[model samples]
Target: MTLSDETPGGAGMHVHRLLDEAFAGVEMGPDQQDLKEEMRGNLVARVTELTATGMAEPAAARRALDELGDVRAILDATESRPGPGEAAWQPPRVRPNPAFAVRTVVLSAVAATGLLVLVLAATVVDVPLAAQIVAVAFVALAAGAITADALRQETTTNHPVPPARAAGYGTATLLATTGLGAAWLYLRDAGLPWLVAGALLVVASAVLFTYLGATQTNRHKAWVLRQQAPYGSDRFTEDPAAAARFGIYTVTVWLVAAAAFVALTLTAGWEWSWLAVVGGFVAMTVLIARMLFAPKA
Candidate 1:
């Protein structure tokens, strides 16, 4: 049967057709046929699930299409490997050290917590509005610095960056710092100065984390490519749909956090309460879990 026949909806069908057209020239051997079929089947299943969940057919189709990006790369990898008549393709080797991974994760968590604590404390201590603003800005600057360092390490090591890429990690850091400074000048008395400070800190932290996340994502992709290159096609890397999904997910998290913050503001009446603290913790937990456990495209 044609690939389009396997798609669940008009959009998905169109995507299936497009993937087929794009990779039409690719010549597959018996060994590669199973791999191609498996990938295609998986995409189809995912698209179906998305549609069944009440996503607009077009959106589901678009998502499915995006998830199938970089099919050509995958195809090249699949076809270039060592075979009966070809020189054996030696896969690039790079082992991720578990200790390093653990250390990175721990350090990232510690830094995040420290920054949050500093912001919360500033809000609670009834410090000068200017001081509180400065503190918030400092935290943002720190987060941005940390993210930049991480990006540098990833690039130097030839790791791929993640999807939903953001620009100017440095700029985000600087802006956050600047915002804090402004907040200090503007916030005063028993008014909403702390709220302003908290908002600036949260925005800065989000930007920093988002950049870090994208970088790590690219790194993971590089690792996977290295491992899978010798065995199968790399067609999946060409698609932009995965990154789009991640962007949507990020926005969703931000909105949820905003809602929680609003609720806390209304209930706590300007106290340095646990509303955002709890929400941030929960958001981070979910994000980490998804990153670690979600099925790869």
Candidate 2:
């Protein structure tokens, strides 16, 4: 069957259309329906495999159908199989372990709480240097542990990241947290040395992150990719007006931020000018979330 020039959905829709055509003239009872669904799953699986190997979605779907051969022959062979109400073989689903999930949650909460307490103490009260250092290390460890543990666990839609890469990510997070803590110390008049160290740590983490991101390969499962195919890469494709508005808003925000930055740099000093840039970034992010991802009324 010929695929439409533009199926709203991606590879999954293509396979679905092909499946519908294949079953068009066939009679389907509950058993047949079950078999059809099973077949659909298998077909989608094959398509996913093909796409991952660099084939286009339509080509992958076509190849999967070609490989599938005669659908009726399989049905005929399976006539004596158990009915839908009985037990049937199905694909195995991968899920995160319950223990892992709980551990991740606990560690994340611990990290968050530690960071919050540290921030509050630094600002609201005088925390001793020894206590602050211990707190920083505790929070860093928690954040790193959570990052590594979470990445190593297989999820429903994505494969577990490689251990080495996961460790690298964890290290980056640890360094970033430590850097932030050092910055806090500097803000509290700990020393200029704290500021220099914080800047170095932050820069190191940023470089590591850049390297990791550049070399990262796709970890998304085939099924997830298929599901996402329909939407394509651009979230705003379906709303040209929204896209235009976002562009306008972003330009406006940055323009205002640039003016503010200049004004702050001249009057308030460069130390405070960076806040304007940070605020601009936050505003842009909020605009994106609201404009593109907000639920339709």
User: How do the residues 1-297 of candidate 1 rate in per-residue lDDT, one tens digit apiece?
Assistant: 123334443543544564565558777675445445445555656767897889866566556757776666766665686574462322334566565466567656655664565556557654454555555555555555555545544432366333234336645665665565455445444357655764776587577757555533334433333334334333324333455455667677877877777787888765744567677778868874675456656
Worst 10 residues of 1 by lDDT: 230-239
Q: After superposition, how far is residue 242 of candidate 2 from its true place, in Å?
A: 35
Off by over 4 Å in 1: 1-127, 155-190, 193-217, 220-226, 233-297
Task: Tell me each candidate's TM-score.
Answer: 0.30, 0.50
Over 1-297, each residue of candidate 2 has an lDDT whose tens digit, in order, gives 443433435667878777777777789886676567666678888888998999888778877887987777766766745563443443335756999889888887877777777786767866777777777887888888888888998875579999999999999998898998898878777899999999999999998887676556668765545444544555565455566677678879999999999999999998999999999999999999998886755
| True-structure RMSD, every candidate | 16.7, 11.3
Residue 180 displacement (Å), model 2: 0.6
- Among all windows of ten consecutive residues in candidate 2, which has the lowest summed lDDT? 84-93
| Predicted model with the maximum lDDT | 2
